[model samples]
Target: MNDVIRAPLAFRNQHEILNMHHLIIGAGPAAVTAAEHLRKLDPNCRITMLAAEGVPPYSRMALPYFLVGDIEPEGCYLRKREGHFEAQGIDVIYGRASSLDTVAKTVTLLGGDMLNYDKLLIATGSTATRPPIDGIDLDKVYNCWSLADAHRIIESTNEGSRVVLMGAGFIGCIILEALANRKVDLTVIEMEERMVSRMTNAPMGDMIKAWCEGKGIRVMTSTQVTSLADDAGVLKVSTAAGDTLDADVVICATGVRANTHWLDGSGINMDAGIVVDDCMATSAPDVYAAGDVAQGRDLSTGDYEVQAIQPTAVEHGKLAARNMINGNATPRGGTINMNVLDTVGLISTSFGLWMGVEGGETAEFSRPDRFEYLNLQFKDDVLVGASSLGMTQHVGVLRGLIQTGAPLGKWKDILLVQPNRINEAYLASAQSQHAALAAA
Candidate 1:
């Protein structure tokens, strides 16, 4: 339905002039998705995708479902149409890109082999954070970032086993549900003051902690594990608060750092991750980065942010492929920083500036007894952000309102008085827009 992507630079298709050799330095969904789109644009181009792990490409997000025994490993594969990569003439190499040079247009693998390319995609994703705790490398300690980690976790953890998880952030909370489902004795240690601190507001995070504690979980906030060591047949965890606990397994879900270590000497711009333009192009010529490794434009704030969510990764992958194929392709506008988390039985969501911007207004209502809450952020008359707990249906409207920058007019006043009328406000606003369009 749309044509002419119109990139910021002059461009040509790879197959138009010659068969372009494209080298991709990752095999996650983002990398695989890019390779597929490139194949569609140039059927005869040379495409090589490198996988840091030995196993087939799988999703780290699906690892939790696997831990809960909901699906097999194959279910985590991005595209399961057999031989998908081979069918597209894309070579899947198994190794890491140890070194790269933009001027030389080459990527040196760990084994000293080199691959020259016309375009390079850095989609190496991220790695689990190994906290600087004593005995953190013990056999029973693990992180749930890769399929290999999932395998180790599911194998070691069992029914009625003692499990101590460090960090109650998003990734940590996600695995909390799965570990609980396995009937393990779970205790969560969070350095933050509340759960999901980065995503939910203070009130909502406290509410979630209370809910989890009520659900028979031992949630310890404002706490840290000072050291961990094996004691006899169990692991002993020492806390910064001078407390000790024992566990059959210790999990470090502290968070993640982007896989940008290889770019230290590559002269690529980076803040939290690889800084890329709207075309997903890095500072280096013909070099691009996407997925969790990329720090791209944030639509809501108009700043660069790492939106590591799956949808953002898939979109980034496609957009990067467009620029790699034809430099004239349209640049990506940006991606919203959003998160919808399902922790055990409770659902929470945060979108845009959930922390509320300065000089802005907020309308929030909470029923702690009923496990329901809603907070709306407004800049002048326009919705800028929102956060909610146990309000699944309202999430869509909240995102819509914030994204569209809708002028609620009198509806804003109504919502401030009666927060429950959010659905009605959305409907009325939509109807008004439709009527205005019809009149036009």
Candidate 2:
């Protein structure tokens, strides 16, 4: 933007990536992040955003706080201040991208119009999926993935209302906390043996479930929601165990799937998600993907994983924009599986593969009576994955060890004998890495 001239491609290898138009599909945090970064880099570049919903770009993560009345609906917006997009010269369209034509470099909207772009980014994010259970389509049944869902739940329920929640995953647990704060007679039903299966191991997850139940919330684990029925305006939820629970409202937070069905015939390398390289570019030229819609490599495992969390989305969003400016000039470091959760008053954290890998060693300590637990996974002498509850100081140390891949050496033996010495182990191991680097 500072005296840098951009122009169209006049030769096969010659290019002007900055002087171009960017059409981004989706208006979530990722889209907004990329748009702002692009504007800063190329002030005169044309940018347009498209989203299926009609609201301003907002973060789904903040919706839980909105339910507890801590913040108003407008507070959940990513760019809450008025005229944000207009001031940035970002043109927003409220429509779905129905298809893509890579050869023509145009995107087809649901309304039968095609939009052209010099570079296209798919940040459409993800959609919450509901299980194939009967009565899921009932009026009181809802999900917590969108802002509209939040409005419906808030409008329909009152304090002390009977509520049945399905799925105790990360998103579900957040909503669970909000519902508890609302004083709802809340009951949770999770198909997994415990809670937060994807983030923590069985023992840690079981402890979380116990902590939730101890808070006077009824938690049903290893259970299935068979069906639901509305009788005289009352919703009755039937479980697989032949038990029936009645509810004033049903909230489903089972899981989410990438919202990329519209790209089925788009000639993009499609799999469970859109295949993308470390640069965040798709198989096609000038077409990149990020957020949940992009299946990029996982740094720890080197496998393609969809991290639907907001931080990963924001990082990849910015990374993809930089690559768009220079044609994959700055490759991505890849994403890791990381999550920190606050269920009620309890704090939990997980990083990388919290569950120990094959032939990997593990160190664990637990005090079920006090709801404190920690598990560390090690491959050879290096810490690879970890999960913890009730320990805030361990958060940075755990991530640092896993990310730096520093050898634990003597510290590994110390952890296996007494995992509570996390701080000491981290200090010793980090110092060892520093000394080794200096010696070399």
Candidate 3:
């Protein structure tokens, strides 16, 4: 183990000791993981986590199941044991961090309190994007991002209640599955041509669309919700295609935006998110950003991008913590941004830059009837991105290769020529990698 020790500053001759206090903003998975990693590096250092939400850091990804009551509230919690942070001597502050003074190394809370820090990490995640539609403020309209939103949706659902979801993205699709399981009359309206258009290609989208429709969930594609109205006790949604649907509740899963408004004028490089270098360090010294708010460089494209997934966020936090404690010995490189969704008996996985035409040639394989599809896009004979549906085993192999940027010349032939024959090889490679990492 590295000999990193977190300690407080010592005072001498009337000069206050400059204790190394790590102040982490946000209590999401990234912040929590960073805190734990920092503790491992420096057990005695002071660590404080400031969160806008009053609840402790929980699994936001599991909100869909919680909405349908498939999982209890406690199941969404990240910690397995009680008083996890307290046991570690880490302080958790329940309040919003309104502004950050990068130069002064201070953070201002919503209640007028300020805290100083030797190093600051901004991991404030993201919030769902609500579109500018008429009557959006009406009751029964909800956005699915927080635990409170899930509870509200769960409370609103009852037998025979009609629920309409806007946007057919991952959140929307997963929520549809959860609600359909409860026999809720569900309707999905998407502005895009197919479901999960951003994450998947057309074949995978069609597979999900067919599956959802087979489950009696009405899916509207290439449609836009122009306005929403309240008709007596029910809600009426008007679409751009001159179609109207009635519902008892509305859920919006349009998209997400990074929580970086507070740092607009704080001298931090801002694009779609706060820009950070490989070390997760901002342009200013002693200041770093991670998680969804940090626009770290994408290894595949060499461009700053925000990947709002829990695993990536946790990895970012761990890397940032390591850099901070180890005096920046190791370079903080980006990883493959991948996402997996298990919805209604279909497993879908995607990684890297899927849409861009620049990287390389693309290869595809599909079995529409069985809802199986695989698309590999390569650049300079190197695998860059892939989308797979109904092929869970193959996704694992592709994800490994993409992450390692391994030479796929030999593997590609086996994968493309005799895919089934190479299953054992894929499993062996994956297990070996896992074992090596565990040993290290």
Q: Encode model 2's per-residue lDDT on 1-440: one tens digit a residue.
A: 01211222222132235458898998888899998988788777878888678777888989999988899989988987677787777777677788899989999877687788999999999999999989999999999988899989989888889999999999889888789988999999999988988887877888899899998899998998999999999999999878899899999988899988988887889777888899999988999998988888887899887878777788788988888888788886677778888888788998887888999999999988888999999999989999998887647778777877898888899899998897888898775565543332
**Cα lDDT tens digits for candidate 3, 233-344:** 8999999999988999998888889999878678888888888888898887788888989888776778789978777798889988988787666565575688888776
Task: Write candidate 1's Cα lDDT for 1-440 as tens digits.
Answer: 01111122112244435778888888898998999988888877878888778767788888889999999999998778887776677777677778888899988877677778999999989888988879999889999898888999999999889999999988889988899999999999999999999888788998999889887899999989999888787899999989999999999999899999998899999889999999999999999999999999998888998888887888888889989989836686787778888899799988888888999988999999988988888788777888889987756777666666668889888888777788888877644455443332
Clashing residue pairs found in predicted model 3: 6-42, 9-19
- Candidates in order: C-alpha RMSD to true structure: 6.3, 5.6, 5.2
Q: What overall lDDT, based on C-alpha atoms, would model 2 receive against the true structure?
A: 0.85
Assess candidate 1 and give its TM-score to the true structure. Answer: 0.91
In candidate 2, list every pair of residues with a backbone clash: none
| Candidate 2 Cα errors over 4 Å, as ranges | 1-18, 431-440
Error of 1 at 210 (Å): 1.5
Model 2 TM: 0.91
Score candidate 1 by lDDT: 0.85
- Look at candidate 3 and tell me the lDDT of residue 371: 81
For model 1, the superposed segments whose C-alpha errors exceed 4 Å read 1-17, 430-440
Q: What are the clash counts of all predictions, listed in order? A: 2, 0, 2
